[model samples]
Target chain A: MKNSFVELHARERALSLLDAKTAREIVGPLDNMISPHLEPQNIVPESDDGIVLMRGMINGNNVLVVSIEGKFQGGGIGEVSGAKIVAALEKVLEENKQGNTIYPIIVLDTGGVRLQEANYGLLSISEIQNVVIALKKYVPVIGLVPGRVGSFGGMSITASILSYLIATNKARIALNGPEVIEQEAGVREFDSSDKDLIWDTLGTKQRSKTGLVDEVVDDTVDSIKDAIVNEIKTKKDAHRTENVDFYLSLLNKLDLSKKLDIDSYNKLYQSVVATKHEVPAATAGNKEGTKSRGRLWFEKLTGIENATSSISTVLHAQKDGKEYIAIVPDSDNKFPRVREGEVGLQEGFAVASIVNKIVADDKDKTVKRPIVLVVDVPSQAYGYQEELIGIHVALGSSAAAYAKARQAGHPVIDFIPGDAVSGGFLAHGLQSNRMIALDDDSITIQAMSKASAARITQRTIAELEEATKHVPAMAYDVDNYEKLGALYKLVKGIGSWEATDENVVKIKQLINEAITSLDGDTTLHFRYQTPIAKASGRKATLAVRKLVDEEWSK
Target chain B: MEKLHFNFDTKDAISKPVHVGVVASGDLEVIFRPTDKETEVNIVTGSDGFKEVWGNVLQRFFDRYPIQADIEINDFGSTPGVVNLRLTQALEELKDEK
Candidate 1:
């Protein structure tokens, strides 16, 4: 018989890894509890909600294993399953606080967030992330991503944040699923039928080279067991204690534009490792006075000749003649990974701080100053250190801050002059009451890179391109995104990437129009009212949400 | 989804509660808890169309082993053979518990 652990079911995998005789399942099928949400959607509720939680012994140490059943609903997490996992982790944390030792091992095989119960799934994931960060302080939260479904969406971020991650060659990890990316970004960017491309982009081998995955093991029970034992035995908390400046200097030495293959990634890795011993030098004589693309846009929009740059990446400007903050990447930024305007740990916290401050300042004021976000973030910075420090919390905090600001009556407007990709866009722009993007090729917005999209969707770039022609969501161009009703306006005739005085004036007029259109209505529900959203399968989500609300009220 | 309840008259009772099988696709779980009243079996299945087949299977198993216990089964489209196997396994565990 083949010794591949990948072929084993979720229960079998968990049982095989732990001491077989001592393993006992918590909230096992016998509990008779299933998801209440799935039934209304005519979806079958598995006895355990497709998540197997067990208390067991691994190499004589007490451990808790949370395994996802990929065969069940693509191992998508719903309320019950999410709660079960969270409860188990919380219990472990509580036990540890009382001087009991119990390690957490998560076997991830999820596509992330059960779309059937979207809002609940989102809330559950946030809770899961909070507990994961809290639990990491005591024990190393080990993540094992074996193949079949692999891990994507919110779970991908969850796995990335683990203290130790082990994956087999068959495993793939990504922020967004291939089909979802294809559905949103178009076939031209990510063909959903190309298998080789998907593996090439998100496969364990490539991810391991990037240093995101701590260990790559063979697809055998013994190999996985050994790796887990070794990690629990020897691995200390590898949290980076050096300031953001240390990472910035290290990032500055290497190139970030290389294709994400093993060889190219390894070269960059070697370069970063090679410079670790060198003393951190001051960031000087490297175009210190020059403003980034984001700051330039901020200057143009606010008419502030020299807007005071605060928190390095975050720039403070005047909007509607009031204090407005614009977060941009510093080209000479100390945090190298987030230099090109990617919202890293520092940027996320900075954005949150600014928004929270604005909210505090405008607490008693009848009229709130509009917070204009000059959106040019490419993506969240992808690095081991960033994950170790819980970038999700930082990113989630920024999103929450924007939501809070809007609820506080601040007309949050997102001006997309450049790319707003993935979690970066989610943190900065998605929470805005009204969003305006430059109708230019440079203004691309999507969950991830086109190459990653193509790989996940198993489609050739050509197929993805062809699909984009028919599907507006698939196209990354701001024009295509505008059709989705997420954007209130798209400014045309921008002659250059650098906004001219005329272009700036036009954009400012549009922002005023957007703010006026809001008419003190600060909710983000207006996005769903767009023709595209109403037509493109959002009706089901709306209906389900309505049902959920009606039920909740009862 | 189908919900069915069955009762089998018996004198003997299960010594302890026992759980067997996983709720994976095409699989089912049988959880047996000791009850003083009667041997009651409650079943909830993924497929609503298999009500008669489930009744027949449970009837046969209860007839074969007249153990007085409250049995609850959550099935995810399991075949008759799989259901029979899980019930037998749970019964065997119950027997071993004595």
Candidate 2:
């Protein structure tokens, strides 16, 4: 803790000290396994300390550990670090293809690639991505995000590319940090000083809520180990395909009415709006808090009255044991202790259900099943108990279900009622075949205001405004993401609840059109254009052709 | 020095060059050669430093590749992506089929 790499080194040393077998078994970087890029920078790098690629036994099964040392430049990746990672990834991939029993685990706590060695570092990051794809072909690439520095930028994408992700409450993951946001957009869009805002925007809870993170856990070595063990135990078959029809169908179901526009999309998708009470829209327990800006937007778009507005409302709905959608009021609610021996249908289940429907429907046209994704997740349930139970496993189970749905060929769609930001959106919203958000008026990206963006970027509110005009990346609007090719479509103007049935029908229609467009080839194009739901049928075909040519020759 | 100019007709336009990846510290680059070689590749780098090495590398590479291609690879330094691209061009150039 005193030093960043101090704990990392100690962990490595512990491995060495565990037994002579440990030392012999652990292939420390001291064995000249350094990256080639380091020498050009003239930095004397430690071999064993940089990236520890250990091939060892975990309960009589072989596993590969790719641990980055936080002490080494905040555990930021560089050429050597990247090469080691890629090499390990390549080796593991090759081994997996050969039917070798090796589980690949990455200990992530990085600030992306080190600027000091930019080019090589960046390339390595890309290679790491390729390796992740390759490795995922045969085994899970478990990313461990705990402790300081966390994961950001290229590292965040790396996490995104992985088969599974595990995070602690202390862990934070974002494409760009708060300070960067502030610097780029100015403090008006985000304020770093607000602790709650910071956590809600980029923290594990926020990410879990948005569907970016697979699970959340407590900060401890043992907790992390348990999560991984659970993931391996419940691992499913991989689904690597290039089919646009399934994803297109899912996107069709994401009912962004013709009225909704980009601004509304950004507001509902990125921002969080608490109901009348000052309680956060997300977070379990209170259930009687204020509605999220997303929910309000949904209500506005749909012209539907909030029939249930209190925890008592949820209680009543549950009491009836009827499958009716109740607008979940957000407040601190940890009351619904995950019952022992019971895995209830949470938001993740909803997302996976949608995906499964699409996959299943792809094979059979007669199957017209409606896949419903309940939009009441206040982010994936966080805290000590969730960690103890291994939230990542639960979350991954949901993600795997979605993957299966894609394989089965059904169109899965989603609509964000409230608070569709970070991990929650990623898990429940993103993985779906298509995602649509309510045209919420009060929806904003930062939980509070621009004040949160200022903390991380060290810029005043005025500065972000000035910068945003030029730097599209700095713009806090959700519409920018769509422009940047992150989101597929943004509905112009419509309340959330009013268009529920219409949205469902429209989505199904769109999906049907998409399925008709796809040919029989499952190539790279399908992977790129089909999965995201935004790319059109033509684009998907182009992507498939491009990737096929590129990958086939390679 | 005999400049053996090899050319092929391409079915599609080679758009413009949008290069990615690296050859080596001083080597590879992915070059977009707009050619008529339906899909053929011709590789010619300054073999001054690595003539035999380059030939060995390309020879082994071409063996796995389907022939009936025309590709001209003028190498300053390129990466694997570029190499693959040049070969692809050769294949396209040599192609008379749809």
Tell me each candidate's TM-score.
Answer: 0.60, 0.40
lDDT of 1 at A518: 91
> What overall lDDT goes with each candidate model?
0.70, 0.45
iRMSD in angstroms, per model: 2.5, 15.7
Q: What is the DockQ of each candidate?
A: 0.26, 0.02
Per-residue C-alpha lDDT of model 1 across residues A1-554, encoded as one tens digit per residue: 26888898888889998985878777767555577655544445667778888788998999999999887777877666776776677778777777798999999999776644443344345446656666776889888998888987667656755778899998888765556546644665455688876676677877776555678999999999999999999865433222223343343554445423445545655555422222111122323444556667877776666554535676665556555556676767766567777887767666665677778878999999888888877777765334433455456556766766786788888888888776777667767868788777766776556676555535578866665665554566777677655567777777327588878888888888888899988666566566765775234334433433332213
DockQ of 2: 0.02
Give the least accurate 10-residue stretch of model 2 chain A, judged by summed lDDT.
A315-324
Worst 10 residues of 1 chain B by lDDT: B16-25
Clashes of 1: 18
Off by over 4 Å in 1: A1-4, A20-24, A236-554, B9-12, B96-98
